[model samples]
Target: MNILQAKNEIKNTVQAYLSKNSFGEYEIESKNQRPLLLIGPPGIGKTQIMEQISKECQIGLVSYTITHHTRQSAVGLPFIQEKEFQGKTYSITEYTMSEIIASVYSKMEETGLKEGILFIDEINCVSETLAPTMLQFLQNKTFGNQKVPAGWIIVAAGNPSEYNKSVRDFDVVTMDRIRYIHVETDYYVWKEYAISKHIHPMILSYLELKPNNFYTVSTSVDGMEFVTARGWEDLSYLLYSYEKMLLEISQDTIYEYLHHEDIAEDVFAYYLVYKKYQDDYGIDDILNGNVSSSIYARLFNADFDERVSVVNLVMDGLLRQVNIYSFEKHCTDLWFGFLKNYRNHMDVSYVDHVKEFIALYHDKLQAELLSDAQKHEYEFVLEQIQKVNVDASLDSKSRFDCSTKPFFKQKENMESIESDLKLQIENAFEFMESAFKNGQEMTIFVTNLIMSAEMALYLSSHTIGIYEKYKQVLLIGSQKARLLDELAH
Candidate 1:
């Protein structure tokens, strides 16, 4: 399964494992719950998903790399204690709580979440001496004598032996004791993720032209040469930051993230074309429905690869609009919910659900579970909420009137965003129809929009005429030009 599918499966597994009985005890006892073991290649997001799962499930998380621990550290240090055996007193050895287990408890206390996931990375790459301890923990959910906290799910991720020679294959006994998920790389699946994440448009466009380069793991004389989804996302961040700073990205920088030479050089070459499009075609102008005839003439003269890159460029802009709409809608929802509740009640009790959203965002931000995009969204919303500081000294009605003023802007912003996005969508389709004689560009744009949950959500309440036509054209290839012409007329 792909990482997204794996994420869903693991989330479901965690929820099922944590299901409670009528008396509030776990439906399945702690001992009976099989710890989840995720086996896959490195850099496939096994580690990242745990943090997302923890945040989404509103649970505590304590993560560690097993390779970073020795047996003593993993199982805790031993100490001498006095014990009475029958009539005689004897010295006994006892171990303190394992640091890993202690961290789980710490998170539970810190977050006030009794249930969570304890994620162990590189579990099979532990030192030989710690291998038995690893297996023991997997089987018994214990690090030495201290068992994992009840209601906390144990999830471990490890690269397969093919990816890491250090991997210790679990025996049948150990394997039978856990729920194992084997993950693989799928470019289309990752593409959806990449689009949602707003990965560097150039990287996305380049990969779209060359899907084979998306995930590569091969052996060469120089050693193992590989590229993975992790590499692409990291590269995306650096590209975004470097471009923002107006710093020139070198071939070496690309190779640093993507170790494969052939793939790196190919991407670098395509990146030059992306820059060419940036310089030649005013993409923002195009999205605003202002396209010069000379620009279309230049595009017609360009090759298919460059045309595809341009399509991705246009799609990237449209998606950005969708992203903005999505964020504004969420912020508006928070304010709307709060005001609704406050208006219904005589007092601003519980401050409505806005406080919950704020608290949740703060908790995730504190835990560093939110991605950069999420962090910014949370911060912006937090800033907006802070501006409407409700004064307790004022009467309830006055307080509501003063504080509710800022949220009114959110409502207006949402309306403006909808209008802008609808116009942008129409402009993108118009430009796609005019620039390319063949409908592949429109095909690419419409296909991506269809895949976007954000676009689907926006379109539920909004309508785009060309989008409806293109969706039908997608089903009938022969009708693509007819549909484009129909929309054009």
Candidate 2:
């Protein structure tokens, strides 16, 4: 299975495991519920999805890499205790709470969530002495003498034996005690996540052009070399940052993230080409519906790679505007919701009330562990709310009126941005029509927009003439292809 499918499956399993009976006890007893074990290659988003699962389930999360722990730490430190047996006192060993177990309780207290996922990474790579303890922990849901809380689910992950020298294969008995999922590298699945994350379109385009390079791991004379989804995502952040800072991205910078030398150099070469294309073409001019004849001629004469690069360039620009619109809409809607809720309170000290609201939201967000986009929205909302600077001495109405200005201006600016975005969409279509016409480039442009969550939303809400027309063209083309395939069959 792919990581996304694994995520959905794991999420469903977690929900089902947490479901309660009429007596409020879990339907699946804690001891009866086998732990979830994920086996996959390293850096393929195995560890990344745990937090997402916890957040989606509205539960607490405690994560640890078991390879870092010694047997003592994993099972807790043993201490001497006195007990009476057969009317005689004897010494017995009792262990303190394991750090892993303690963390679950701490998270439960901090987040006010009784149920959650305790995710242990590199479970198969634990030290030799800790292997038995791990098996026992998996079989019994215990670290030391403390069983995991009733509502909590235990999920463990590890790199496959081929990926790590220290990996230990579980016996049949241990295997049957848990449910295991094997995940492989999947570009399309990761692409869906990467697109939502707004990974550099250059990376997306390169991967689309050379899907084989999306994930490559091998041993060579120089040593292990690989390119992972994590590397691409981190590189995307660096590229965007460097672009903003006007810093040159050297081949060494690409090499730093993408470990596979061949793939890294190939991507760096594409980066150079992309930059050159950006310099050669005026994206702002295209978005404004002012296409020079020379530019149109260059595009018309360009090859498939050049055309794809240009399409990606335009998409990068479109994504920028659409993301801003999304952020604004999210922030404004949330802020406006607060305002609507606070409207019933007509007393003084609304500023303090608003401040409390912001602080509570901030604290809750820390516990919820939202995705990158949502985190940005929440941060922006809090910042805007803080900057409102309403005079607390004034009456409630006056204070509310003063506090509302920030979102008011934000909403107005959002409207103006939407207008500009609509014009840009129409103009983008016009450029595609004049230059690429009904070529695959048009299909690429329309298909990508339809795939994007924000772009799809924007397109659905606003009826741009050329955009709507191209969408119909795409629909008809898809139907025709399907019909032709049917006839051929």
Candidate 3:
């Protein structure tokens, strides 16, 4: 299975476990709950999937690397205590709570979520002294004498023995005590994630051309040569920051992430082409339906790889519009909800809810907890709320009209909006028709655009006239038509 499939499987397993056990209830004498073990190569998103599961399930997560712990930390330190056995008093040994278990309890207190996942990474790479304790933790679901709290699920992950020399293969008895899953790298699966995450377009276009380079691990005289999904994602963030600062991204900068020299050079060369496409075809003008004939001429003259890079650039622009419209629609809905509640439910009080919301915002603000970007969002939401309240002073219908004016304006201009999106789609199709001729490139382009969670959510929620028109544009050609038909089922 790929990372996406493994993510779904783990989510389902967690959901089922929570449901069957009533959110962590189990009898000590009954069958012991088995931990989930994710066995896979390093940097294939095993740890990331666990975090996603935690967020989707709305539960707390406490992650630790067992290799970072010693035997004392893994099972806690021992202390002497007095105990009475019958008539005589005797000294007894007791252990403090394991740091790992203490972290779980601390997260529960902070998040107020009793049920969650305790994720231990590099479980199979523990030190020799801690190996027995690791087995005991997995099989018994306990650290020394302190059992894991009810309602918490245990999940452990480790790189395969081939990936790490320190990795120890689990015995059959230990393996039988867990639900083990194996994950492999798949470009197509990661591509969808990359598109949704808005990974660097340069990386995306490069990977599109050389999908085989997505995951590689080789040993050479210099030591180990490797590239992993984690490496690309981390590098994407750095590139984005560098671009924001208007800094030149040299080949050395790329090689820092992609260790393979040849692969790095290939990607750096493609990145130059990708950046040239961005400049030559202004995405802003393209989005505004002001595309020049010279752009189309250049597209026709370009080779296959260049054409693919152009397609990636255009698709990136279109997705940006989708993201903007999605956010606007969300704000519009929030505005409408506020207006409706304020007018129709005049007798009822929203004081408590409003106070709670304001209190939460102020708490975050005063604690200096919000990042600069998050602080900007917090201010924007407050501004919107204040604007709506100010509009409430007008007459009932006038207030309603004022509050929903932007939404109504957008609704009234659906035709023009649809026309712009349709033009962008047609422009892409025209290039695809002339450049590729066989429609394979067009198929991949449209598939990348439409097969995203964001796109699916937009289509499902915004079934208005403009979205339907945009959908038609996406489903125009035979290749896209077939793809849409398959997705519909």
Q: State which candidate has the highest TM-score.
A: 2
Candidate 1 whole-model C-alpha lDDT, 0 to 1: 0.82
Q: Model 3, range 1-489, lDDT digits (tens) per residue?
A: 899998998898778667644455543322366798998888888888887788778777789988999989879999999999999999999999999889888887766777888999999999899999999988889998888888788999999888899989889889889989898998778887888787888888788777889999998898888999989999999999999999999888999999988888888888887888788878777656566778778867877788778777877877776665555555455545555665675443344334544677676554334545455555555565554443335555665555556546644454455445556655554555555554456655666777556556655654445435544666643465655533422
C-alpha RMSD by candidate, in order: 4.5, 3.4, 5.0
Candidate 1 on 271-348: residue-level lDDT in tens? Answer: 887998887788899999999999888888888788888888888888888998888887777567656666677465
lDDT of 2 by residue, 206-309 (tens): 87667788888889999999888899999999999999999999888999999988888899999999889988999998998887999988987887888888
Q: Where does candidate 3 have its weakest 10-residue lDDT segment?
A: 22-31
Residue-pair clashes per candidate, as listed? 0, 0, 1
**1 versus 2: better lDDT goes to:** 2
How far in Å is the alpha carbon of 169 misplaced in model 1? 1.2
All candidates' lDDT scores? 0.82, 0.84, 0.74
TM-score of each model, paired residue for residue: 0.90, 0.91, 0.84
Show where candidate 2 strays beyond 4 Å.
369-379, 382-406, 472-489
Sort order, TM-score high to low: 2, 1, 3
- What residue pairs clash in candidate 1, if any at all? none
In angstroms, how far off is 376's CA in candidate 1? 4.4
Off by over 4 Å in 3: 20-31, 348-353, 359-379, 387-438, 459-489
